[model samples]
Target: MDLQLKDLKGIGPQMLHILRNNGIWKPYDLLLNIPKSYEDFSITSIEKWHHKETITCLGHITSELKLIRGYKKDRVHFQAKIYNHTIDIIVFGRNYLIKEFKKNDCVLIKGTYDLYKNSIVASTISRQDKQIEIKPHYRIEGIHDLKLTHIMKDLFESQTLPIYENLPKELLDERKLMSRREAFYQLHLPQTFEAIDEAKRRLKYEEAFFMHLNMKKDEKIETRAPKPYDIHQVRALIEKIPYTLTLDQKEAVNDIFRDFKKPFTFERLIQGDVGSGKTMVALLAAYAIVTAKEQVAVMAPTELLARQHYQYFKTYLKDVNIALLTRKTKDKDMMKHMIFSHQYDIVIGTHALIEEDVLFKQLGLVVIDEQHKFGVSTREKLIEKGKHKDVLYLTATPIPRTLAMLTYGYAKISLMKEKPKRREAILTKYITKQTIDDMYSMMHSALIRKEHIFLVVPAITSDKVTDNIETVYQEIIQEFPHAPIFMLHGKLSSDDQDRMMENFITTPGSILLSTTMIEVGIDIPTATLIGIYAAENFGLAQLHQLRGRVGRGNLASFCYLISTKEDVERLDMLVQSDDGFKLAEFDLIERGPGDFIGHLQSGYLDFKYLDILEDEEIFLTAKEDLEKIMNQPDFNSNPKYRYLYKTYTKQT
Candidate 1:
């Protein structure tokens, strides 16, 4: 709607100032607002109302009234009959209400009831019969409950002005969901709490429906015919590995193979936990595709990760002609020329690989590590640079299957549930104050074993005493006087970070202090202990990832969750289970989807009013319904679809 808050009636200069500051420029912006909470201001009987609680009562003021005029003000005493009980009312210094209180006048008295005095300390006496209110509270800084409602009520009353009709009556009827206008109305000015909840649900459903539509990417689509390759060759590569592949990793490899047999372009996601072997799966797939006379582009989100992948590729397949293309790589033109001329079999790099000048010859498979970080558009651009033979995504963050299906609609998924046999499951514990000395003792023992330590703080520097990189570094240096101590965070230069990481990896009995920025894809197999000082500041998935840096080797590992806050459910959940997928679901449900979505897919899923966790059922229903409808041949011409489609286009 073109209806701005400026056009709405009863919004004077003060209201306009508040509205503009809060980003509510238009009528629909108000629709996007969600009430913080609701309060009950309904009229109640004397017996039902509690002491010191503000309640409203509809009662008749008796003819008998006493007025005591003091020097400064006047005190009025009166009797009101409510629910057949005679309750005394004392109105002090509110002389203006005296005129409104007439004999036998049925007035609404709002005040706190006193049980012992058997009277109400009246604040307001109104002749109007006040209806019961389930007050919807919006916490705008300068706007009170009444002022906010006045603006909302005015917008609702302006019926000729418009809000976008997002869904059709047929869809509403099919789902038994409230109409957009009705949902907005009830949500702003609720009739009953049940109706308010229903309104919230339907609004979330509509937003999620639009979100799914936004993420849909089939506008320019084509598939490739599968090129046959020798299965025995890929198997021999697998058998040549020093250790047997985990069952889940083997199955993931097989899933990629099956996708290769298909006639369509391959879009698959290899999901696993922190120590799970997703990279190995990608390596195998890349080898298979490159051996079939096609090049593979293995992309990582960061330069460090890309370099790590290139080193792994070289270590495993020494004969493979792999090129590393990055911003820091020397001779950019030469690298680009080599890549364009197909002089290399496999190319690994950061987003620098997607520059227009860098082209791949017979690019068959695109393997993206931490795929969520690249998003769909960057991924599509990379695929456009290739032959579109197949694409594989690797991620450590695990989404539930239902959520995965709803989110990555077109991409098939294979999960790596098992870590390697040599890697022991990390023993998790909640660090207590009493265990402080024991922790240092364990560190001393780990020092004897030549293992390193990871001290993860919540920040680079902090106002707090100890839970930061700088302070923790100082403390650790004091404890281990001769040991090598290194620090890493985002503020440091990338080259400095690489140097620090090298020192950390090579130096034995070392301690590295860092922030959550280290949670990406750091492989420190010799590190046996990771202690998160402010454990409560991190989520379940993140905690799992930080703990993953250790326990990568055969030696035992421990994750110390240390925090001042006791009995944190998320922290406890971390200690109880090691599975990343279950922790992701728990974090989504308990803490809300904001952090989870923000960490991975930041810009793509910009939801204004929907809480994906709370509205999961509604979202899934919307997903299923929209999926079926969009598959129809004439869905584009449908009125609701067209309306929303136009609105979405305008927004873009």
Candidate 2:
């Protein structure tokens, strides 16, 4: 039943608008608008009431409800007698209750009891005409709890719920799950807690099953043969490198080389912790492709990062012709000409590389740096530049192993956990605003050692003229009196940012006050001290990435996380552990999967009831069942499976 809200009785235009705003336009949306919480209205006596405990009591109004203007707002107060006890009923900002209640009127008061005030803060006062078993509360704005509950009751009694079932009967029976119809009914009108739990379990399973099916459908197994790489030339270049490759790096390189040898397009994700030399591995892969006379394109999220990659590639691959394409590149026509004519063997740039004017000459490999920054659609558009080209995703944010397996099970994964031999673990500390003097002392000592500092703020400017880059710069300058301070932010022009970064890199003891723009790509080896303002505002992965900037060089580095908030539990996790993977897991647990991986990637999951961390068993079960269904001979012919696939595809 794909019924519109207008078709339902008692739903007016204003109610329809409010429902639509809350993502409920159709009957199905109404059915899916499950309760946020349930209130047990089993009436209790006022004698048993405790402070701050939500309870329901059946009482009669002994005194007239009077509306009095309080100091801040209007309040309705009345005395209600309940089972040998008289309790005050207080309704703040709700004056309508005065007109709704009368003396000696029998009513049910549901709210929290305030023992100190000897009053019960009434959330809802309704006439005690019918018995209420359990009350389901919704979060719809501009609507009362009783009104929404009444609407839900009407919807359920009308039996207009959509009867579309996307789960196979055999699987439902095997799992002993409730029917979709019964589950929906029990979720909103559960008679017992067991029924609610069973309904939630079925709903979670269905959500996971659909998510897995959607992921499986999007995965494309490449069948076309890829351009082969010249193994000897790749090895020669690796041998000529000045530094030795870590064991993990060597293994990653080997995995990519092996992937290239397969008679299909290679799709792989390379996860490395910050300062793990992932760029070197990417460069080697590009070299392997370039030696085979095929062009490679490396895309970074920002122009600064793209330029960094271009320069790094140019330095290492002296014989290879590389071109950088960005929005700011003045010689765009020349670069486009070189790219189209195959004069450049490798092209490095930001999203500008995927523009219509840019065309590749035998594009064989695509390397996406900070891959999480781009959405799947953007990646797909880039890959469409070349037919069945090998794609490599490089990210410094280490994903938990189980999460990676569940999310990117279709692609091959290579992890680079070890940092370079010369790199030192950053000394991380948590400091409060009161400890600014100590931080200043530490900064002075670092500056005395000829080390530059990075002062990262959450914002570039503030109307209040405090806790921003400008304020921080002024404060630092006043503290040192002779220190040079530079500022960088996203609002700055590309050339200005590059110039400021270059100046910071070349100048010793200089302080660069900037935003998270410097979180990923700017590499200043001499910058040994970093002060992050409002550090609690940043994610654990992001904090880790920022700390990575300081510890790149052999000189011991320090990171000071300055936060004003007392709840530093998440920030404290970063201080205790240096392992990016462990931090990522902690972050995943602290924040849900959607926030941890970011909205773009998490949109692919689109799970309504299933959480990757909490519902691991449900996800595993769905994965196993999906694998079995995929291997079945009559999978496509199954109606329930087809319905589920169609439902997800349509939604996407």
Candidate 3:
């Protein structure tokens, strides 16, 4: 079945636009948009209401609707006594509920019974008869609820939907996987909890299996000759360097060098914490590639990070011809020569280097920093440059085990467990507004010592919040009147962001006020003090990464999380601890990796009911199933496996 809707019999441009907006371009995708949860408002009476102390009710409005003036937009002032119960509902939201009200019609109202001023009040209200069953909500887009429901209803009712028959009948019978028709029908309209669970297990397993198969097949294809790369040279370079490589870096670099000597291509992911020497390992790999008389390239997710890496390499390899290819740095002809002519031995930049026009000069190795920030297509493009040369990926937030197996399980896995020796741990503190004066005084003393400071605000501009960059910049400038201050945010022009960063990088006793935009690459060793305002609003992994920015260069660094007392509870985990691993685990638990997937969430695996963090067991099982399926020569022969194939192909 064609993924494009133009191939569908009756899909017009208007409907196609709506479907595309909702990320439903194909029939298989529609099948995967499983209902998040069901809304059951079928209780007959208060006595029959499940006895759960709270329940949702949908019924006809038998009484007159009354409206009263609200004190605020959130405060609702309306009274309607339902037929079955004596409770009256009070709705709010600037009369948002009034639009839904149809005189003498049914409505769905949801709230717990509460006695207010001697009268019962149902706070949150909805339409009773209009309550949708098995509703699925995506991350909002140009599409709306009405649009999606209409499409889904049409697709369900239409026999024009081509049945996906990718799976073989024997496989479906062997594994007892549901058929294509049954799975699609049940997934959308699940009748029981058991059915939902089984369908999810089947779908998740199939996704992991397909991803693994592709990687395995890709790895199996031999791309380059076994170019002898001497580990001794890289080892000697490491030894001569002033700073010793961390144990993780040593092992990773060694593994990389050994793999480079192999006949097959090297595809590896280096999982390390922030401040761990991933860049050094990447440099060692690049050195090996250059020694082989082949070109090497390193791609960073951001221009700032790419420039930083280029500078690091340029300083270390004076003899090597290094070039930077970012949006700001390279001219068109220079970029073309760097790729087509292979003019530079090592080209470093962002996605601009991965274009079709960018050719390689005997491209031998590709290093991707912060690999999670990139998509599979981008990685594949970079890999294509190397003539099947080795690819090394470095990431601070190492893909979680379940995700790694789903995404890169077929590739080799290496862990960088420790930071460099004698590394000073970041001292983290959470301070309230009342204690901010004390915090400032301490920072002032640090500044008096001629030390640099980093002030991280939640926003670049003063919009949508009481505490913003403008407010924080003004307050900090006033407090440290003697010290210079600069600000940066994502919204600023790239030149402005770079200029501000450069100013802070060159000058001492200067406080750089910026947003989380600086979280990835800008490194200022002299900045011993980092003040993060509204820290509770940031996720734990992000908070850890931001804190990691200050603790670089073995100095005793401090990170201040300035928030209100009310916000302290939300940030207790950060103040009480400083382990990135533990923090990551906690972060995953608190926030279940919502939109970290490809396409920021949509094209990514958006698990409806499954929490990738909490349901670790399910993911582990999926991985095991994937491994089992990959080993089988003819997976199509298995009934269960065939069903999975059918579902996947239908969506793709």
- In order, candidate lDDTs are 0.80, 0.84, 0.69
What is the TM-score of each predicted model, taking all chains together? 0.79, 0.76, 0.67
247-360: candidate 1 lDDT, tens digit per residue = 999899889888888777767888898888888889999888877888999889988889889998999988889999887999999888888788899999999888898888
Error of 1 at 291 (Å): 4.3
Better of 1 and 3 by lDDT: 1
Q: Give the lowest summed-lDDT range of ten residues in model 1.
A: 213-222
- How far does residue 289 in candidate 3 sit from its true spot (Å)? 1.4
Best by TM-score: 1
Q: What CA root-mean-square deviation does each model show from the true structure?
A: 5.1, 5.6, 9.0
Clashes of each: 0, 0, 16
- How far does residue 468 in candidate 2 sit from its true spot (Å)? 3.7
Model 1's TM-score against the true structure: 0.79
Superposed model 3: Cα runs more than 4 Å off: 1-222, 327-343, 355-357, 371-382, 404-413, 595-604, 608-611, 618-652
lDDT of 2 by residue, 381-492 (tens): 8888987689998988888654775555556789998988888778888998799888899888888888989989988887743578877777777888888788999898
Superior by TM-score: candidate 1 or candidate 2:
1
lDDT string for model 3 (43-116, tens) is: 44655444224555665665566556655545444444465444555565546556657556676666555534
Question: Ranking under TM-score, best-scoring first?
Answer: 1, 2, 3
